[model samples]
Target: MVEHSNRKDSRAAEAHQSSCLDPFGTWKMSNAAHGFGYPSFVSYNGLEMVWAILFYVPRWLWKNWEAGKVSALRMDLNLGIISEVEKKLKKKLLIDYMYSNLKHHNFWAYRYFFCEFLSLINVGGQMVLLDRFFDGTFFTYGIEVMSFADRDQEDRIDPMIYVFPRMTKCTFHKFGTSGNIEKHDALCILPLNIVNEKIYIFIWFWLLIIGFLTFLVLVYRAAIIFSPYIRALVLRMRYRRVKRECIDMVIGKSYVGDWFLIYLMGQNIDSVIFKDVIHELAKKLGYRSRDIGET
Candidate 1:
């Protein structure tokens, strides 16, 4: 009787598996059979073409530029928090503000940095369709800082509470709102956890790292425009007062007259404009100029 019951259970399991493998199931058995074709996998290919033909393309093809800029800004903040010990308190405060005050806003800033670019690329069409379909919804959420109490600080500051999964890595969260807005939030952290959540987070963390590294490599590979060696050479010697006599010792004796002036000009432009920009951004953020240059 036990043997018969075991056979019946085996059959039931198989049936259940078959049901899960149904094409219309939320989770497909295998992606191999989907007939979306290579066009579906193409990045900005057909989509761009369609948008351009429809005259809906933004000037300078900058539709995604805003999203990309936000991602970069978030990355910069994450990198600063991960590396700068002094900024820990400030970072914790910001996170606390986010957690406590954030609600479902018009733009879902949570998912911008969390979701993998590849995943978004694959699901872009459906996402765009949803945005087009729903254009009047808005919500907000907050991610407040929850940390351990610190006795050393007079203000009783909390130790930064990082929700790390098994593997130390970054995480992204993506969501859309009823107001036809979408946003992404990316958090960079170390790989500590090894479980499912950690695995997923690490996947995105690795993806971002790989993407940044690839960009550097490509910049280096284009030797004519700029190479890594040239960049490093320029960076080391650019701000220094390089008299004409000492040019050959650094940056190669080859760049003598206009090129040297151009390099100096580049440095000057960066020094002046970037300082002003930093000052403005700091003012806007209600931070001091010292904060802009910190770490």
Candidate 2:
């Protein structure tokens, strides 16, 4: 009786482990076939449509406001106030200035970086686990353009958009030592019963617009943070009399340039270049009596 109880417990534990280990199994059924299809149109009462529009319009307006702030930051950088601004802030490094200011002024900065880090982890996990270890299939639906079949037609190549009830399947082969092959299939179609084509189109369009605006905002923020380094490079080029060797030596050995480069590399200050630069700066700044590389 004890042996049978132990065996049952072991089986249950094994099943739990399998479910935890399989990524698809957690969200979907294990070794089961699934089919998804949508109706041509979904019925939505006037009240529901009105409510959706009301909810989305405010969100869109807020997003635009945030984007405007980002654009202003970019314009400021373009006008060449980076060095002046940092000096006023009493910060030597652009990264330090940006980090302190963003943390104090914008709560979204933390959320944005957190979301980006999470997205990277999610993508990395999917690429390694799902793409490498799952034999799976996916299907999607879209409208295709068709040309007029009749040659005599005035518009011989009349471009007509036709929405057909169609599906496409893509499969990824699982990696394993076993010779046996296993397959899992999943299917989906557009214009689901819960949402009409108009709603779908509106949602997709707004998502794309928001994504583009977010990208612009990120670019603007990056410009603000790296503007000093960019200005340095531009000035170095503009004043061509400064020899390449001199620039290299200053960049590789100077304290100030080292801090700037560390900021450019996202605060990774443990690099060899950073150490050498710090050592050089220490001697120049009278922080140390001995020069670098000297016994």
Please tell me which predicted candidate would have the highest TM-score against the true structure.
2
Model 1 bad stretches (over 4 Å): 1-194, 220-245, 248-295
- Candidate lDDT scores, in order, read 0.32, 0.35
The candidate scoring highest on lDDT is: 2
Provide TM-scores for the models. Answer: 0.19, 0.23
- Report how far residue 147 has shifted in candidate 1, in Å: 28
Regions more than 4 Å wrong, model 2: 1-36, 39-195, 228-295
Q: Candidate 2 local accuracy as lDDT?
A: 0.35
Residue 125 lDDT in candidate 2: 39
